[model samples]
Target: MEINLIFKIAAVGILITILGQILKHSGREEHAFLISLAGLILVLTWILPYIYDLFVMIQDLFDL
Candidate 1:
């Protein structure tokens, strides 16, 4: 929800893209794939708490 989190996520994405490209061009396709997957999981871990909070808010709003 904060601007800093958005910047952090964008930085991670950019770093991961650069790393993946370097690994792929060097013929380490598997490592590149793993790097991409790790990046995705890392971003999801950052965002999941926000998603959970949203769900909780919705449930509370509806008296669920």
Candidate 2:
């Protein structure tokens, strides 16, 4: 994990929160939900590789 990745995730979270708030205030609740979901998926994609590496390391540690 790198510092840059954490920064990127934080930026995305901030942007998504702002956007979702705007959408909700504008009565676009469904769109806000979608936007939040997209953000979650986006962040998950970004972190998926690290998650896989973690799992691999755990497996190695346990000799699984």
Candidate 3:
């Protein structure tokens, strides 16, 4: 819930996009694709815990 997490995610996304573009333009298209995929997975990994916590909270609230 910290403000810093938002910044971190944004920064990672921007960096990944830039890096992917650089790699692709440099002719390493495959690596660029993999880099983008890895970045997505990495971002998901960072966010998954928070998402799980939210789901747990919702379940508890609904007595599920």
Task: Give the winner by TM-score.
Answer: 2
Clashes of each: 0, 0, 0
**Mind giving the per-residue lDDT tens digits that candidate 2 earns over 1-64?**
9999999999999999999999999999999999999999999999999999999999999999
Instruction: Give lDDT tens digits, candidate 1, residues 1-64.
Output: 9999999999999999999999999999999999999999999999999999999999999999
List the lowest-lDDT window of 10 residues for candidate 1.
4-13
lDDT of 2: 0.99
Candidate 1: residue pairs that collide: none
Return the lDDT, model 1, position 38: 98
Q: Report the number of backbone clashes for model 1.
A: 0
Error of model 2, residue 23, in angstroms: 0.3
* lDDT (0 to 1) per candidate: 0.97, 0.99, 0.93
Question: Between prediction 1 and prediction 3, which has the larger TM-score?
Answer: 1
Instruction: Indicate the TM-score of model 1.
Output: 0.94
Ranking by TM-score: 2, 1, 3
